[model samples]
Target: MTWFREGEELDDEDIVSKVDYTTSKLLIRKASLSDVGTYTCKFESEDGHKVEAEFVLYIYKGPSFHDTTIYHEFLEGADGVVLCMVTGQPAVDVQWLKDKEPIPSTHRSQLTIRSVVRADYGEYVCTAKNKIAESSATFMLHVFEPPEVFISGDQHSVNVGERVAVSCNVTGYPQPDLHWLNKQNGQELDMAGRIHVLDGLLEIKDVIPADGGLYSCMAVSTSGNASRDVSIHTQPGPPHYLTVTPGPTSVLFTLKTFPINGGTPIKSFVLQWRKNAIEKWEETIVAASDVLAITDLRPYTKYTVRMAALNNVGRGQFSIENTVRTEGKREPDSPAISTDQAKVEGNSFSVPLEQSDNGGSPLLHLNVKYKEEAEKSEWHKMQLPSDAKSVNLKDLTFGSDYHLEVEAVNSNGSSIPATFNFTVPEQPVSSRMTKGTVAGIVMLIFLVVFLAVDATCCYRNRCGLLMAVAGKLSRWKDPGLKKVEEGEGTTNGDVTLKAISKPRRSIQQSGVQTISKEAGHLTEVTCDKAPLTKNEKLHPTTDA
Candidate 1:
């Protein structure tokens, strides 16, 4: 026995079959669209007899519409048909409903309208039904005339750097796409950071003079497209490139006019200048000229100049301020020199001079004269370049003072001579030798004074005439015999007293004193001991 579908033998790949001599069973696995057909089973006996049985297997699938929704627009009195194709098994039936309600003649898959009317514009639903399931789709039907777009609002005027918005009202059966375009250049305006478009409104943030033109708001649709132009006017901007050229007693100004003109022709230009911050401005009117000249200005004075353009609206913003100073008079003043900069070297010196003010004139030359102070020699003069500020004098005698004089000469005349006096320094060896001689003399004088003072002190202390006299008296009084005493005591001699000798303390040895002693005994004498007469017996005194 074998099973077949569509004239082809079915095996385990298509259907499973279990067979015996009298009964058979067929099983279908994983049924699909192609499996929904007639299936047959045939049996052949050993005597060549055949018998067959036929079976129809149907697959059921849910119904679904071709599209979820549709959008269509048609003019009045136009014929149109909307299709609602459904895909499913067992032949699904589609019905068209208007506003969720079924239409009387909408039995077929397509809804046909002989003539579209204004009242027929509403939501239409297409529902597909079958035994297994049903699905539906919706569509918006618009029955009206073609799009008629109009922009509302008149011409607009806005200042530069301001914000503006323009509206474009549109009338049509279906909503249309809005776009903003530059009618002058035919370029579409994009929704950028500075410009935006929402619904029918076009907005511009910080509008400039260049943005002033014919702007078109276009409404685009399937039926057609419409556009309208709006005139936009922008006010004039500030003037540019204002410059001033100074003269001796006047000034000339040149500038460019404001290009936009604020939607009006420029009538004139206003020029203003002031001496300084403390002065009021002086204004002048010029008849639409790019250049103007102002005279009778103070010489060598700084002034601030500015200009603005005048139009039908008003005066635009002034150009950036420019500062200029008029030239001074022709005759120059005397050049001032710094006398402290007169420098002297070994046998050379340099005189540096600077002109404090040019005094409306350029220098032609400089004359420098120098002469020795003690000599009867004539002054020597030298000519210097106009730009030279200092003159170097060389080969001069060392240690000799010289007087220098400098005068500046211009086209007008020479200035008063500037005088300076300077002395050249001595040679290095000569200066050092002089200093050494003075130092040596001072040291020798100090040594002589030191020796004299030391000799005087030694004579007064021990080796002078007073000590000689004392020694002679001691010798004559006791020529052969001498008295002796021990410890702290007094001694008497049997002799005439010539000069009494007192023990003296030596400053160099603190409290130690020197005393004369007899030949045979040693004695310690204190400064407070009393004198004894000759021929008296000597006695030793002891500390109690």
Candidate 2:
């Protein structure tokens, strides 16, 4: 290996061969400057002979830094348009990444964003790269808010002579401009007179019918524009009341007329009503000043009434309807009363009474009376409940008999009393007894029989038990009997026999009493002669 100076590789000499080389040809490979500075070649013979050669190589330099340029400051909402220009030693491949995601190149694919919104503000990168090096440029995108409109006050319903105001509210990066327009005019409103534009509000003062129109507010921004529209109307006045005076089938209705406060005088009035059960309306036309008198109406019928006023523009909306019925002067005919057996509810007798009339007249009053007997002097008259169809005999005593009658009354006069009779009698008292008493009595009889049978069986059983206990003692082994004590508190050897002795003596005493009675001998067993143990243990007889 050998070291060479600057420009030395261009003048370096070729290697010389030895003269004893015997005219042998030497092979030298061409080396360019790219293979610079150091090189070594050595040959070794079989007997340790050696040969050597050295060379240097160098190359020229090219451009280093890239001229990839990026464009900036795009207007917001301009479809995200952008430009990237690049210059490099070797033309590099250009690629785009938005938020770290590769962007595909298609016809719609440009550096532009579609439907750009506030959330679309972010960093976008353009990369120029090759096998050796890579570089990227980041452009920060900014999205401005679009413009919009806002209404000032709620304008659903506005009264006449009252002011209504509307406004346009907007926002943008460059602060949007507001405009007002009457869509009916199709032109921009330069100033406010009828419709005043101050700040963002379009105020309509002392609103009149003529002030009604389509109002629009528009907002323009560098990003976009927005608009909204609302309609205005003049409100009607408070309503008037109409009165109807009666004639046969016709009635005259008088309206309390008044001029519209903030409006023109009414020109015409419309009167409408409907007959009972009728679906369609009957209209009457009259001068706005004239009172309405409808003719040929149904007698004694209900009618729903309504009216409206008209001016030069059109009809003001109708007033709320007030219902009225025609008058028929006929008096109510006598109401016939029909009566039946009445149920006596406490202090009252409820009776079904029916009365009917073609004309609508309420029964004003009724009266009732009763007779104690067929020979009673006169009907016992009592004014009945005003609404009662029946009368009650509150003062009558139980088991008493009485006949009842009722009379109907209206505005004209009372009807003849209709008579119906019923005999009031004492209610049966047996109904007061409860089933529990009979059940208790039956259960008592059954219990007595059951106890008598059980006692007799228990008596017979006692005799057998006593005999068994005696037999067991008599058959006891001597070893078991030895357990008995001998003296004082001990049971004596005669205790069993003595306990058994009384029962046998009782049988004998009963035999003596029976024998005495059969033989016609009146023999009394004296207390002194009675067996002491038997008398003590048997019934334990007492002096009483």
Candidate 3:
């Protein structure tokens, strides 16, 4: 077998090839793009048949980068782009590299930075690779920015004839320039002689009323300019014509403030006072007015007072001192007293009193006195604390009238006595007597009802009860009496009589017989002789 390049025969040592004559197969190794061309193949059999064909061969290579290096420039916050174009047969894969490290694969030819910063200024590489070969491109990015400026201090005040210095601060890539200006007149301040400007500081010597206006410190940079204003003030003079007035527990001071504020308005007034001239002074801040009231002071005290005026710069000198005395302690007013009903039990009573109006001073004690109205007894006194509103009186006589007086006392003096009149009520009747009377009446009524019921029972039963009683009485009297038969007889001297039984049944045939009392004789009676019963006859046995 043989190979050709550009229509020239190639030697076996210069190319690698494999051929199989039985299978009619051919294979090539280590092929490159230069091997892309047309080739011819011929085969002949022993039977005298032959075949001939020509075909074109194409070789695929890996990606090739169009540019080896790239450059890009942008501000800190601007966007940046870098191109990594490549060409090769059979599509290749592309990726980005940052600082010699492989980045994520995007299959894109361009690398874009959405917002660039200082951290983004570094080496970047774009790589394209395929199965066979790989290529890369490099780029360097630069980011730049302008300067930023700011001022430091603001609104400072200095006293009159005092030296003052104001400073400013700046920050940026490039250092900024700083200067001082008079904001009121829109004029630049001279930095020579008495006024000097060094670095970021501005110094002013011998401040006066003319220099009390607004002054500004300005900072200039490539980016922009920034400024801050400072307000200066010259102190005013002290207040004058101080007057003091004393109250019960406080003091009032009136003063005349300076008409000209000495280049600055008075912000406030200070009033100083003390209990004694040698003690530390207590101060009270007051508005820009003529009068000041200081409270929470001790009563009945003497104090020394002074005044001063204050502005934005500083406090002025104090005025002349004056002495005044507070009002003295006063006594309490008369106390009003009220009383509840007197509770009287037997010979004891309790009276409750309520008192009000302790005046300005706190009450220390109270005095209670009482006397009997009827007998004009000596007054009894009791002492109690000021907080006590009720008093209990013991061992008092019952059914008696009392006159009570209460007085309140404080540190200063006692008030007018408050008087009240109450009576120790009479002893009430005992409940035992009423209960006994009710019991007696109930017993009497019960006895009467018993008697009436007994009578009713007797009437309902007729005279049987009485008759039985009589029979019993008779039996008691004649215990020998016995029941007689029909033929029974009693023997006497020729006076024989038959005894009868059940006299009530034989009363129809029975007769009553009588013997003459003058003759003193006895008689025998029978049923045949007397046919009428004694109960049937209305007439008496003896002739009337």
Candidate 4:
């Protein structure tokens, strides 16, 4: 090596050159500016010096790729996006692939897919590469969609004897294939037995109640499989009714004919009548011929009837029962009686007897009677006041008991007597003195008249005897003392003022008691009369 000095050179020691070669060591070190120099020297040996070339060094960084992200969950038929950003001193290229195939270029087909679906489900790999570095990441895709189905008629309710149609409808993309299966079993059902398919619809014609059940429609596709379930419901049949010809006796009914559910043609019927009110049943079997007559049926009764239909699917739901009732009967009754006041006075009563017909004849006879004391009285014969069937009795005593008896007489016979009794109250009276004084006066006048007549008769008879004696003495005596003429002093009874004959006395006053066999027993009747005043005429005892 040669040295080139830039600073001041020293003396002989600094400029000294090596004249001896060492055989034991070699010196090698990192180059520095201190080692840089240019120097010239003469060789001691011939043809041994050689020359070498100079060199320089330079450095730079490269690109890198990391931080991959997919902003959506992997799902079938759904689009997904993946991002893997690259960072480096140099830029890199970016691209996308599905199933290891680059996407095609078209109006709908692009590397960035829209509305991705099940076919796109797979491992999605993303890669980045540059002059310096390269990287890759992967994501899984899942595809799925549930199934949908429907029925043709969509009917859930149906009556017996009514025809029905059932069908299943299914729809899906990718051309889904459909089939039918029973809910009770996983086995597939045959297309036979009233079951058929049109297009994609599975149909069951004339579906009966037995045909009602849970059915499943299964749809299969390249992507997945789906199924739907449906329920079939039915209603009870129409009503069965029973009617009675003759009604019941007491609001209880007995049907004449058997109950009939009109849904089916009747062969024979069982007549069952139940009291829905009481839950009691009376049952009988009747044929079509005997349906007209129902013996011993009671009127006005309530009943319920039921009918059932039988077939291979077993007896269907019973028909709705009907309730009926019987009619009512008539009753027998009797007549009634009432009365009105005929005549009434103070403390006295006069009643007109009127007889009204009540389930009987008109010519009814009534017996009239009076009694001071009821125990001693007998019926009296008094003519009725009128010719009419009704009668009135007058002059009844006050404060006296009266009884009346009416006998209902018909052409056939007389009925028991109907009796009525009543009493009339007496009128109150005052003045006790006049009743006795009048009796005394009546007695005194009778006594005084009788004595005067007796005195006159005695004087006439004595005078006659004196005159006879004078006559006889005068005839005997010489000196005859002749009687004075008696005619001169005699009083003429006929010429005198007409003397009133003593009035005939009442039998009550005469002290005579008489009785008649035919006479009704005398009843002591007390009449309350007005007090006898001076001008009032006394009641005559006997007509003279």
Candidate 5:
């Protein structure tokens, strides 16, 4: 057995061959391109007869790259190309991958991008394969973008001793460095002063008029630098929002505020007033922040008021004049009264007292005026004390409509009159109670005559209507006085009273003595011994 190259026998000791009864085998270790050729195997019988077979051995190699890993850089929106240099015996098939994900490619061993974005950055693989083996190459793509800047506000207006801030936003692939500059001079602003930059913002504290200028904000990066500008202005304006209140003797001036003071602080104000257009002007200087009061003014007068503010730049223009009139001596307000407050009694109007305003002066008196509504007559007038509690008008004509007016007077004037209207109710007919009184008097006279006759009959004959009533009443006397001893009463002109230990009322430790009244005599007798004999005269016992 033999292995051959280009029909020449291979004699390297590393090649081994083995012959068996029906087959021949050859083994080669670490074969190379140089060993690619035609090879033959020989077989012989026991006789001198020979058979030969041949084969063409072609050596194959897998793909390889010049660089295993590479880095590529591109700006945004630019094209990018990565090439894989490979060597192999057979043709190689190529495929592309981005971040470990497959990407279809038209060219073998090459990857192309028409437009690159930030998403295109990161690891990329170029895979190649042949009949023998597969290999890959790696590329790291980086996309860059230039810096762009955006400022917040275009302009600003500030007051004196105020704080102001301006901000800007920057965008770029890599973070940008920010700077604030004075646009008037291309110099960077100080970082350790009242005006400085913090976190992409430009700030100014304790602002002055000089601080008003064009400011620039810049952002810098490896790709590019970007800038934007802003402007600030300062100016002083006139005072605003003035109000005036008038009283009887004075005028109050209210100066609300001034909005734009430029960059100067206001210290004071000057107020000028005139009694009228013909009179000379009087001016007073007051500290800032005041509700000024000018007193001692004559009542019922008109005046013109104007004011100006004082700042570092001097006084500004005067505000428009405000015309005000002081109040005159005024009549008191109307008293709170209603028709219901003046109640209507029979044939009269009862007006309940309610104190009214006295026009800010001591009250002189309260005057009441009244009249019938349907009659063309002069009103009846009445006067009452200032503190009177009520007003009553009586003897008013029934079924007549009436009107009443009430007012309070002071030294200044009379207050407004409060009026009420009501109608007097009609008088009713004589009542049944009067008739009942006449009937009751006639019955009383007849009862008195009957009582006189009954008394005369009882005195003369010892029996009459009143005598029967007396007997019946005596039988029903209080049982507690019943008896020391019980005795029967006689029908003839005698009354036998029992002398008992019990008295008419329940009193303790008491004795009883009997007293009987006869036809012409009252006698005291002892009933404890025995009952009196019928018609027997019992002598009066003075000591009994």
Candidate 6:
């Protein structure tokens, strides 16, 4: 017996042949696609008679996919379609399924996703069905999400010549590529310069006012890209805050500002803070200074703080809000008052103070009470500023002792009272003068008055009180000299004197010229222009 396949004689050693009395058989093993063809069996006898039989064979294959790729990827929110390209000897029916559930509108071996979402990602099964067999293939579907990015902080404040770091938080299916950009120039940040970026963190060294601006943090990936903006604020115009400290009952904020606006320096800052969700704002004002404390706040509360800069112009726009929470309630500690250092000047007294321990709260002010040491005197109350170094009491009575008490007050309550006694001094005066000194001053006044009278009399009458005294002294010395009596014949002061009417007569014997009239005790003398009375006869006559 002989076997032939596809019109060709079979030559494989694996073919088995058998012969019997009335039948001849040929067997073929391991039949495959290549073995599908016409087969012929030949019978030959020793008497030279030959016969051949041909049989047609057909091998029908099941359905199979064309491509070997079993994984698919698509961006989220994008339209995508996955087709199962199948082949087989006979045309087959195709269907699609996912998670063991049939997919709708997938009769054409194609799975369509409109606006792909994360829920569309998973294993997708494509099955081809035929009369003889059914085959299936699983392809993994992955949906890529765009990088969702956020900055650590929306705004970061820093002084000139400072360092700052900003971080970006990103999440995506595929890790995204991060880049930091400066919005000032709209350029990629220079990693070789003062700024650098590493692992989504941007670090800037020695930042300047020019470096302060909006920075873009971007994340790029195969799917898509996303970005967030960060603000780096410096000084001038508006102020960027530096520090915020919250206590039990107060909030303290310190803002960093340069001393310049548009050629004008900033004069002040308007700070505003309030509860997180409240609309009405609470304002606290004190003597205009650098104290930026907002006191008398509820404890354990969340607050939002902001501020605006004030210059020659009105207040600028308010700054970004900052969320803060005050600490829990805690009573303030007692303060120390330096009563020993108290000072008194005339009608007023001032008591000094030392910095106090405010515990968990802030010192609101100081209270002082005092009263005259005298019995049944009421106490007088006075208040001082929180930042005052001393408390002063004016219009106080001098030369009096008083009971004084000083207590430090805070939001919680007052501290232990410091009690002491103080004596107010009177107006200052020097030591009293001696009795002898007083008597001497009186005698000196009398002498001055008498001298003034004598000088006045002498000017009009050529006579004075000293002259009268001299006359009286002379009379007393001799007790024989006649003393001028008051109102005698004619007082010089009372009478008018006449002019000289007589010429002098000279006595040539002594070269002397005497007045024509003389008093009883003396005579007034005069001089003549004649030389020694012309050296002539000695005569005493009244002639012109």
Q: Top TM-score: which candidate number?
A: 5
Which residue pairs in candidate 2 collide?
A: 33-58, 35-57, 36-57, 37-57, 79-113
Candidate 4 vs. true structure, TM-score: 0.28
**lDDT (Cα, tens digit) per residue for candidate 3, span 410-490:** 766888887877777665656235877889989999988876775565455322344345445654553222222233554
RMSD of 1: 22.6
Per-residue accuracy of model 5 over 267-380 as CA lDDT, tens digit each: 777778897788887888777765466656678888888877666555656778888888766666555554467777778778677776555444678889999887576798
- Of candidates 4 and 3, the better by lDDT: 3
lDDT of 6 by residue, 45-105 (tens): 9998999899887767789788747888998889978878887656688888899998876
Off by over 4 Å in 5: 1-57, 67-69, 159-161, 236-544
How many backbone clashes can be found in candidate 4?
Answer: 18
Residue 505, candidate 3: alpha-carbon lDDT: 32
User: What TM-score does candidate 3 reach?
Assistant: 0.31
lDDT of 5: 0.71
TM-score of each: 0.31, 0.30, 0.31, 0.28, 0.35, 0.31
Question: lDDT score of model 1?
Answer: 0.70
**Model 5: how far is 499 from its true place, Å?**
99
lDDT of 3 at 273: 89
Output the TM-score of candidate 2.
Answer: 0.30
Model 5 worst lDDT run, 10 consecutive residues: 504-513
Deviation (Å) of 444 in candidate 5:
99
Candidate 2: which stretches are off by over 4 Å? Answer: 1-83, 87-115, 119-146, 152-155, 172-174, 186-194, 221-225, 236-544
Task: Put down candidate 1 lDDT per residue, 119-210, tens digits, no spaces.
Answer: 88889988888888988888888886556667767578777778989878876656677788877568788766576677778887897755
RMSD to the hidden true structure, all candidates: 22.6, 19.1, 19.5, 35.3, 19.9, 32.5
Clashing pairs in 5: 484-500
